[model samples]
Target: MYGLVDREALLAKVRAQMHDKRYRHTLGVAESARRLAERFGADPDKAELAGYLHDYCKCWPVEKMRDILVRHDMPRELLEGEKELWHAFAGAIVIQTELGVSDPEILQAVRYHTTGRPGMSLLEKVVCVADYIEPNRDFPGVEMIRALAEQDLDEALACALGGTIQHLIEKRKTVYPLTLLAYNDLVSRRDAQGGV
Candidate 1:
């Protein structure tokens, strides 16, 4: 199992690698993750760690990311999409191999932070929702989503997934199948009163 990284070192590395805007986003994600952790009864330290490193590969050159994906034998389906969305998976690998983040929960949080999966763990939901509704995020209706997160996590996730699906459709972008499945799963779970 991988051990936790030194907090200061990890933050410094993230700051040095990310652009100023991205650095701010990381800070926002960290704070949001911490809050969500507290609300959901998750480990704030792990949430913060996962949030800090979730985008570690965001700024990597496309070629480098592709190379890493190739080395890892990542599914061609996963590699077929836009480069913008590849960072989540790529970042997970980097966090595991480069940053020594071995915790499965933390790694999974980073992995699915972009394209959510069905039956998400609490930590995963926390990181995913936090990334979307962080203070630095200024998308339309973000405040409302943030409020929803505080009230009902499943509702917030449904909203976030719906918003993402709408955005993708409006942009004429390919919607990853996993995201749709995740959205449906969340809606179904909520309707069935299957609490997370």
Candidate 2:
């Protein structure tokens, strides 16, 4: 559906939209997403595209993001919740309405990059895990997650989600419902598969 989307131009736009550090991270995510998609037998090109635009609205002002969120009629809870989550929600709308991206997979990949939902697609899983394990990212368990990502997408995502939840709990931060739902769904799937 998005055959007319210009990948290079979109990349350039994304690069221009972000600061140097964030742009570097975006590049790292795109490369990581491409590699993960290749490993998982998904479309590397689409993964790269999604990764590049996933944080398109990260640099936008809070006021502008709030406006976009209202314009799109996003979940009232999201609008009333953490300001940090606005980027992912607003980025998806901006990607479609402003950037002219029409593909559902790409949009979903951007939309759920922050608070992932249950039953994510391969592309969504690839983007989420790639964002967590991007080369520039250096967290406590990043290496382990990166290794897990190289081996198993589902396991990598489950670990990332679990880690995020644990960190939030440790810091006494709000746990978005979707994040908990995604973690539970991954755990359930793993249980069903008799894998750990």
Q: Note the clash tally of each candidate.
A: 0, 0
lDDT by residue for model 1 (60-174), tens: 8989999988899987877897677788998999888987778999999999999898999999999999999988899898988999999888789889989999999999998
- Check candidate 2 and list the clashing pairs: none
Candidate 2 Cα deviation (angstroms), residue 37: 0.4
- For model 2, residues 14-109, the per-residue Cα lDDT tens digits are 988889999999999999999999999889988998988989999989999999999888888898878888999899998899878889999999
Cα TM-score per model:
0.94, 0.95
- Model 1, TM vs. native: 0.94
| Residue range with the least summed lDDT across 10 consecutive positions in model 2 | 1-10
Candidate number achieving the greatest lDDT relative to the actual structure: 2
